[model samples]
Target: MDAVVKALSARVDAHDAGEKIVHRPTREEAEAAVRTLIAYAGDDPDREGLVETPKRVAKAYRELFGGYEEDAGTVLAKVFEDVEGYGDMVLVRDIPFHSHCEHHMVPFHGSAHIAYFPSKGVVGLSKLARVVDVFARRLQTQETMTQQIADAVEDALQPRGIAVLIEAEHMCMSMRGVRKSGSSTVTTVFTGIFREEPAEQARFFTQVRLGK
Candidate 1:
């Protein structure tokens, strides 16, 4: 059953890989959209102080959502198999990231905790963080981002198990609506051994909360 799940996950990853190659709007078009949004907000986009705001915003958007150009699999392509038979779980925690909410387009900033049990080899420690960043620098929900990170690791490394947990504070909630500040959203995903074994899952959770 585990093998079946991993196989299906790999197929899904392959299908998704092909879907990311869509055309994107030009910078001028993006700037024009920003100007339209500014006008929609009842602000004069052409005003002396606001005239350059659209250009600045367009440039910032490219950096903020740069994940669209990155491929998670490519980032995990280079692996190291000389672990001396170390099969224990590899955990990387407190990886800070900033992402935008898909619905509100507001910012959500926080950290992610990732872990995986290698079967034959392990990926670079920093690549784990890069995978997190690849999905983070896009419009996302915490739930989807958590699963994407786990799936990317599973598909690329075929680990014995994978676990991902993310905790973030969304500006959409803090800066508007209920105005609840300091409130964070936590999402988690577990696969393979992590999903089949409660003890392993518990350990992952405990380790994540230990220093917090």
Candidate 2:
């Protein structure tokens, strides 16, 4: 619906800054849309068992897609420059996340591995996980999400090198199409030194796969 698209577009930063402001639809509108979906799915929306489903779905969507309301730059704004010149590879691995596949609107859950060689300073270890969560709580493809995470870090930290790897099992494939439940998709993005040096890329992979 136009209302839904407008509401979603209102939350995106890229659509701002010179674009006309589009107001987000009311909760009632969202619920109505959900009811429409139920009817389209051949379910009676007014049935007692399904009467409250629309409301529940609307609430769940707010939490699931809360990433649209967040800014990754704001999360990574505070840089800790007091690392005592300890410039080395900071790797955070096995960060669990669940995202919806943009194409099918089905879930793809996975772990992310992030590494950056700090130049100016370092960020809190937990911030890395938060960054991952920010991007994950949205409709996305694994490849685009992987690069978005890396780009966010690269922009915020200006790291000497950055490496990001994400592996996810898409429900679109497992629950529908091919029905390959255990098959996973891996995507990686490298910048700066990681892009230039194969040894650094190998080290990153080694660190991520260690003990696994």
**Model 2, range 141-193, lDDT digits (tens) per residue?**
89888988998998899999999999889999999988988998999999989
Write down the RMSD of candidate 2 (Cα, Å).
3.6
Q: lDDT: which candidate is best?
A: 2
Candidate 2, superposed: residue stretches over 4 Å from native: 1-9, 13-23
lDDT (tens digit, per residue) of candidate 1 on 28-58: 7878999999999999999999999988997
Off by over 4 Å in 1: 1-21
